[model samples]
Target: MHAFRLTVLAGAIAAGAGMAAQAQPATPAQLAPIVVRDAPHPLDASRGDAYVATRASAALKSQADLLETAQTVNVVTRAEMERQGSTSVAQALRYTPGVIAQYGDTDVRHDWLTIRGFTPARYLDGLVLPFGARGYAQPRIETYGLERIDVLKGPASGLYGQSAPGGLIDMTSKRANGERVREIELQLGSHARRQLGFDLGGQANEAGTVSYRVTGVGRRSDTPYDHVDDDKAFLQAALAFQLSPRTRLEGTAQYQRIVSDGGGGAPALPVLGTLQPTSAGTIARSRYVGDPDYDRFTNTQTFVGYTLEHRFSEHTGFRQTARISDVDTDSRRVQIGLMASPTQAVRYAWAFPESARAFQIDNQFHTALTTGPLRHRVLAGVDYLRETAHFTESQLNILTNASGGYALFDPYAPQYGDFDIATPPDGLNIDQRRSQLGAYVQDQIEWDRLHVVLSARHDRVRLDTHSRQAAGTTTDANGDINRTTFRTGASYVFDSGVAPYVNYATSFQPVPGSTRTGAALRPTTGKQVEAGIKVQPEGSRALLTLAAFQITQDNVSAPDPQNTRFSVQTGQVRARGLELEGKASVNDSLDVSFSYALTDSEITRTNAADTVGQVGNRMAFVPRHQASVWADYTVRSGPLAGLGLGAGVRYRGSFFGDLNNTHALRPVTLVDAGIRYDLGQASARLRGMQLALNVSNLFDKTYVANCLGATGCYWGTERTAVASLRYRW
Candidate 1:
């Protein structure tokens, strides 16, 4: 049987088992039970507010307990991030299954993650961050302003409109909920890193009708690379107002500025200096591959958004959300040219001035009702997105030797001179615009232990591109694409607390170009089938889940066989995988999070004679096996009471570097450890004080993190340590 068929068969068997267990006669509820009080805070009572989240809203855009949803989704709560000292998305998802965080390690400025085998879309509070850094730079969100991060695995276009086949990532922002909140933190770390951060929030009036929150961070650090530094400042503010018992409105604003000499790591070479040593002497891990004078990236970003929601009676509600953002960037870099020899290489430089503006809005209506013996919850929404960007690129005149190109006698010791590099009169000037309108509807139905989900969406997308030059403005590409997608799933739960589920989903992405015949190409489409089993023992906080999935993408662009100069849409790729996750509290003092994944990806079909024979090759940068485990323990009673310790291990299998599979990367394993002490238990004066230390790559093991065929390879983060002092009220 085919792999897809096998997956379906397994799901059938699992579902049959669940049905069999449900057939047993109903039993009376047990009378003897002990009641335990929970934390007083509302945040602590909500789902996903604890380290081991049992509920999430990302998968279905509604709060649903994990076992009730058919898809595989994981939520990383704020408490987990604090224990790990995670300052970025990459660090927060380091232990998650089916997510490859920082796959390109070369770009430290961005959260470069690949879910399953493809790049997942990014969302902030359920709104898409369209395009990402594909053309222009965007602001990096501060972790201090986030309440949780959710990863929804597999195709989600049925609701999100445009998405990758792998999955989607959604971040929930921190907002005031009428509770008094105050926190301040100071930190010191390796590389002369220093930082300060604060968060404040409170209710404005005694009636608790108005609430506000503010978060900010400032940091400066010298990186491991020579002449490279990281500096940034960020601020975010939010306000909430309850006009009446049935109506609520919220507003948010954020601003960020950053200046950096380089992105991350040492400049990468080919296999040399990566898998093998440089022909010259060993290449320095801290080598300055770019000119210090010309290498810099500066950016400023601003965002404003609002959300309004109203409830009518007990079963009807409406919500509207809108956001707009602007980003401006100036970047210059003098990079290493092709190596002439082990010790010699040429140099080139380039600069870019870019700006982008984006706007988005979503309106939704939700209702709950019953039809006969079945209960139904329905959601209908309409969303709109508009984005425009302007960019210019300039390069140095290497031939003139006035300001460009360099001749390095020894790569280790570089020479810098006045390189005449500037934007030419005929430099490239590009203006691009994109707009999308989408409508979607979803219905969730339940009867006793059986539940079902169905959803559909339609999208109309327009793309326009123009080149502004000395002569005139020329239209590069302009077209419109329309698509409709769908998703359906079913799950059944047994009295024993075991749930078996299966789902199928479709996705689509608009392409902006034309085909060999000058006809606008259609959107790329993907289909996936997934099945999983979830176990949550009754009366316990422990959870275990296992899932299997297969996905195939079609309408991929490839070289036209009939017309050598054009392209066709006859390409296909397939990915299949198994994932396992377990979260449990071994006791009152110990908690563990563990996960593992096995993925197999391949380019099944394609055009072009040069690549036709390479159809079976594995996709690049996708590890076949990956696993991680983390454990946190606190001393409840002892001389060392109030002390907490955490440790983790992460392992990734080797992977290929390019489509041709010419270069390979070695597998690696890393260790992390952290320790913290709460001073509140020691004295009343220090009631809200705490001190903590965290270290990653504890062994300082040096390894090649990743490599791009023609670009460069990067070394993983070395041993690093940080100490923090925090106070809260």
Candidate 2:
């Protein structure tokens, strides 16, 4: 089956390349080349004036043309996000290729997504968010402060230490870009949502050597889900200074706060919410199943960072980037437990309070030189990360007494009480600190039409954790480990503008657990081989990529045989897939993006008794087939020349909901559409005024978005609409 898929992918690539070659005749004048010594980095081109990007830096950590790189990289420009009226990171990624956005459904606390069936790491600028491990705390970033987002596909541990094999998402914050910026926006939407925001930036000094930018947002909203209200505020400021022609410095600071009703509560039965209405008196779609008194979540985050760049010589340059961040969250909610039948369910109170402080630094040196006919771009870097986290949890017994839950009441008519629970003491569960230091080197060699990239890195990681108990004594769990990772790839560009490439990369992630012998287990390791074709036809603003890959992970944890409280490393998983994506600016009036992915993910081996017979079971939350298409059109050279319209459709194929393949979620399709009118050309006074409206799930479909098991199912969102008015200069 794998061989057949590969053959089909290859044939598609060949046919695409041939069609591109035939579309444009190759003439001497059209193929004429020009070389300049002081051209700007390719990354600068990706931050273009439009929505279509042709270059990115996330894959190589340096400005490079995407067509020349031997990997898949997708760029979501700020223009694209604004056009789609995206309010969250997950919303911005909905149209991106090869990404499963908002798979967690109504969980707005974090931007949950998957890349190629695996969870990818999150990065701010170039530093890792460092969450999702034992007791690690991650911050939810507001999308209003971002300038752009870059998605790099495939394993990247060879450059960035300890990352998932699938890929990573890197966000670039808004900063002073030397262009004057002035914008103000007001938005109103369904569920009584209201927002006010502004952005202002320009030169800060008469000498033109200094610049500054500031962005702020305030929002108050309620979701379609009953009683789930959200209030948020965000502010960001950045400054830039050009000390000299060869030296420059930039600094940034941001603060954000969010108060809301706790995350979404899944249904007690997988089939009750969508497949059938709850048995208790017509469960309205707006019913609130959770307690309104105990449901609350609050989070606060602060970030400060700086970047310094200097040119030592014509052939060499260096940059240093550093950041310090703090995140704190407090949450309490009443969650539904196992269902007794269709209308009755057990409930329990849950609370969690966590805080984390992290610091990171990266120093890199770059040199571009040539030897004979081979041109080389070499990069060497060192990075360090330090994070400390404190967390505590408390549970209220609410399963035995009638006051604890609605044992038989209707789900649509929830009852609430004033009973209050005491907050848990800090450090009652775990306190941990993690530190990592890594050094890496990479070289990109170009000889004619062929390009080769080689990179290697070594990381030294240390963890010190203390488990706390009510008896006042703490147990220390400390460990240190070292690892080496590498990556190599080569690509050749043909006359038809098609580049065929192949790559091999490795990744490692530390797992927090012990064996029966009281020894820390080794980190999980992953390896992958990917081969693909990339095409960027000449004289066209379109890009196409076709790739197939296989990934294997070892040292996965399973239940320990000797000790029931600990775990052992005796499990493995394999994921293989094919992806095809295309993004194009077909003409001055039309733009389109499309993607399709096929993922086959399964647990290959394990020693745990519960999973011994489930080696072939499909991985949880990952669908077998996913596809999406989006297009926008604007009237050109007509009376409605400034008017635009957009529409998209997303499809997710059926898949198992659990690792054991015991339950399956049905396939679903969603539609989205938008309309906008620009008033800039109408009159001098209205030159910068515009109005737009967007709708998601236009058909108001009712379906199960995801099911963790028989008792944990999330309903997809119903139809939603947002309208906005903005003025910009």
Candidate 3:
């Protein structure tokens, strides 16, 4: 199977290259004008424009320029997302290289992602998502109201504080861009799914001083199960005011709600004796046990920011930015299923439920000073966040048949089972709060052909916990943790259009849970060493980068035997990898982008005797090899003028399920294709209207996305299709 997959991938690459060679050269008449826009602030002049704005530098530029960053950044533009008919974040990232999306169940609300071997830290316009649980689960944020999605790989701790060592994702909101626009869309598709959305944005005055945008989305759908369903709605609005020629202010507010009926399957059942058949008939009985489970998740977020720029003289100018935000989230889930059982066939039936409410406030300030022959940018900020997590559970009793199968519940019969049964006082109402105070500074030095960056930060975090039970008993816990990190890097540009750079950076993560000794474990520390080469031919439309890096972490935690849910900080791990990424626009008629990663990770030290021999094992869910390629061609002349065709393929190597490397899931390949036709009519109602169709997993491959330590697992999605239409002014 692996050999066959490789052959197919090789063939596709060859075919794409051959097609590129046969493509006709674009002439001046066929070339689209590339217009450049001014930076939001004078200090932002040094930063590259991007097609999808997310990072601090990119966010200040025009929204459409986010695709021009020099780093290995990928953007899912609104146009592409609509064309692909993406309903969720996972679906949008499917074709992005070095990104892995794993769905534990069929329901899309519980989906999660891992990028560059690290879990994603969700953000909105550079602000942290207010409510993040330990399991990487949060209230679903609808994508319908977003302008674009920006994915930044590598440590962004220089700007964003308390982040994962891997990277960060910023969801840019739709805002008024000084244009009058209004549109409505309706979609009906498989699974009895229906969706409706409307967008409004434009200037309210002739002076272009006042502008606003409002967006709303609602969806409903039924799954293949008997009682499984999904419902969601979202509304967002933004207002912008121009204070003067050199200053501006903007404010935004958003609200979202998600409700789901327990319909998807549960984690895979253990295969203790023998492997089960692959036929759908053999797996039909593996249904989600929480037949009556129901959940509601809601989020409210608001932000207000201002941008200022002034020129003290012709050679000197000052730029300043400030922003404040508030976010709140509430969630509740009522689950009815089998919690646990020694034997797989006769699991006990019960009801387990949970809820959480979180709130946060953040503020940031930045300034830039540019003088003759010297430029300095300084960033300083303070962040404070507080969250309260409440949990409750109860046990229920239900009779079963002799064959270990129970009769289905009759919805009409209210007395089929005991709905109010009490269990022991094993659960508690817990309130946890975290306060973080941080400050950072960075300086960028530019010489004749050299650029260097020096940065450092110090963060102090305090955690407090208080717990109470229904009986009025209470317990309290408190701890403080602090870490200081720094990074230095330099890039040298040559006349030959080649640039070489190297960097060394450090990161630290505070262990959330307690240790075996009842003492709070210290923060885990990590260091990364990387070197890379970048090439961009003069006046050419191509960019290439190759980087090799090694990362090591010390004081990693190992599970404590006394506490089933906690671990002791006494382990170490290391990872090394090589990455190659590039983009080429052969001309206005053709464009291609590709990325490949080779990663190896293992446990270097562990306190557990049983895990000593697993030093060479691959890390869980970390594939050794991953690659993706995308290409598109636009017809220059003929009846098919302005028509475009696109196709891409993604491949992931096999990976282990446990630290011991005892079990493995086979690798898989996914393919996507898209086509777009432009209906040109400058004055007609359909002016610049485009129609697109996309198909994913064209071969309909079946593979496992994840497994639960040989006990349970999940399978990837099957083939899917989406069609869409868009009109631009």
Candidate 4:
């Protein structure tokens, strides 16, 4: 029934589903606002906190043109995460482009990354941030409550639904806007790291139609290893209304708490003193393998969200979004078992405790149409999600029998007190449940400069598992899945701005446990083929993109080689890539960004007849080359006016941590620096004060950040320094 019918010409996330353009307030049958004079995109609503963002309502939910949305979208804006002082979300994506933000080692709970070669999917605003079955309950948000952070690359399950074909990461909190900001900050560096942060927004009346925002942060930290502790508490609150002109609303609440190590156990060391070198030499990057009065970790998170909008007949309208979540996790660690030589190691005491709950919802319908010269945009939707989790774990290990082994450890020379654990007999339980349902539709077309898009989606997934053992024994399991996805694209725009695009996408993932012969575990399919070229040189505010892509994934889940401890699902993987990027302001005292990437992952198929070459190898930590560049400068007038300077460089190229390709990693180059000063440009009692300094790996290099085999090696990330003081109104 394509008779839905015409006037939503501005797009606040209609079809791509980030439901936007204020997400509220539109009195019944609203119309009258459609201005297009020599417009090629650039409709209205110029970013909430501008730093050059030409729309990415999660990519084409609409404000269009990140080169007419053919895919490969990326934005990190809240002014590029405060000009790269970013503390988390993988350091604000480390200059994006085919991402790989901190893989394996320097773990800060979770935000571990990879893209273009698996593990992407994570969103919060457009839902789906659910991770079940419990593993420390995964929740860590609070990059100062976010305001931007989107990255959509390949395969999005036709419009989001059980993703991962190397793409997806949403985030975008910090709501209630019309732009009236207030800020505060206090931070102290290195390991004694201390912090306090705040952001406030306004407009609660005066015909402003109501709006409010509050963001917070508090922290006490220490972690470069030893005893492992990093503490934090965060809060968020938002509200917005404007009910009528057709209807609008917004609401939010959030809270978070974290206490480290929950078996993250400081990089979880081993590989004989980190990648072979320990004869008591090296291996001291703050070393501490658990035991400061029995090592512990805690995590707690709570969230509530809402968004609504409506319009009945200027052409058609309706929208909705909802969320609810809760989680609590606790962990105890002593972990590092087995080495027993070279420099000695053998210990274990691990314990896990968890709880979780979640709910999600999304609904939408929008329409616009034209006949003669061709123009149409349509969207349809449905979504649902549910999750639940409960967990229990305990382990204790020590070798030598006759009187017993007593957890001995000695990374060169180290010792600690109070250790004895063997707790496991409360009821010994585990329960997990999951549900998902989705439906989708989309069509966006125009024929002036020629642009076309098509979308389709369908999904159903369910999982349930239970276990109870304290001697009595009980076990139950279930899994059901179904999927359908597709996407297609084409673009051509020229007015001296250039655009050339081509796209194809598909993805689906669902693999949750079992297969050591217990069966179950199937679902992993992917596809991608892309080609791109985009540039905005007409008036030059700068935007350039160049891309090439290829990807394939199927079944995954390897290692059986005829029963080598059982595990199978017939694996296959392949990735091909090339990306080049540039973002620039180039004037008003220069600002620049650059990126480059080339990946070549392959593990084309596994089970090589037990010969163990694992079929063409290469895919752990996937990196064939990477690059980055950054620049910032401000000093408009004479005498260092409001002064600022920044610098950056990053490169990483060597990788291999498992899957039959013998370990050997060496390739690094990093440098970052920053400085700022502007006491209100020097008068009026420091109008909005500012002072800053930053440093990251500025030459304190000591490598090896991956090695997944012989005990798991890891260590990378050294120099860090920070200083700050800020104020604004």
In candidate 4, what are the lDDT values of residues 1-729, reduced to their tens digit?
Answer: 001111112111111113344332335554664323233323223333554565676755545658777877877777666766778888778877788854533666667677876778778777877565755576877787887788888888877788889888888776765457688888888888778787777776678667777777777767677767677777777677767767778777787777774344455677767667865776787787666665667777888877787878665788888889887877777766677777777776656787778898888787878879987788888888898988887535442334675556776677775545454334456788888888988887888777888988898989877767667665666788889998888888777678888899888888765565566677889999988888877655567889899989888887576665345777888999898878777776787888998989898886546476677888877778888988888897887898888888878788787768787677888887888888888887988988887877778887777777766667776888778788997
Whose TM-score is higher: candidate 3's or candidate 4's?
A: 3
Ranking by lDDT: 1, 2, 4, 3
Q: 202-229 in candidate 3: lDDT tens per residue?
A: 7767897777777777767654333455
What is the per-residue lDDT of model 2 for residues 503-593, given as tens digits with 9 covering 90 to 100? 9999988876567666877888999899999987776777798999998989988777666667878889888989888888899899888
Segments in model 3 whose C-alpha atoms lie over 4 Å from true places:
1-76, 79-84, 104-107, 133-137, 223-227, 263-289, 292-374, 391-428, 467-476, 609-614, 660-662, 680-685
Q: After superposition, how far is residue 597 of candidate 2 from its true place, in Å?
A: 0.4
| C-alpha local distance difference test of each model | 0.75, 0.75, 0.56, 0.73
Clash number for every model? 3, 0, 8, 11
**Candidate 3 backbone clash number:** 8
- Candidate 4 achieves a global lDDT of 0.73
Better of 1 and 2 by TM-score: 2
| Model 1 Cα lDDT, one tens digit per residue, 402-486 | 3544455355666655545453344566777889999999999999778899999999998776655446634366788788999
Instruction: Looking at model 2, report the run of 10 residues with the lowest lDDT sum.
Output: 12-21
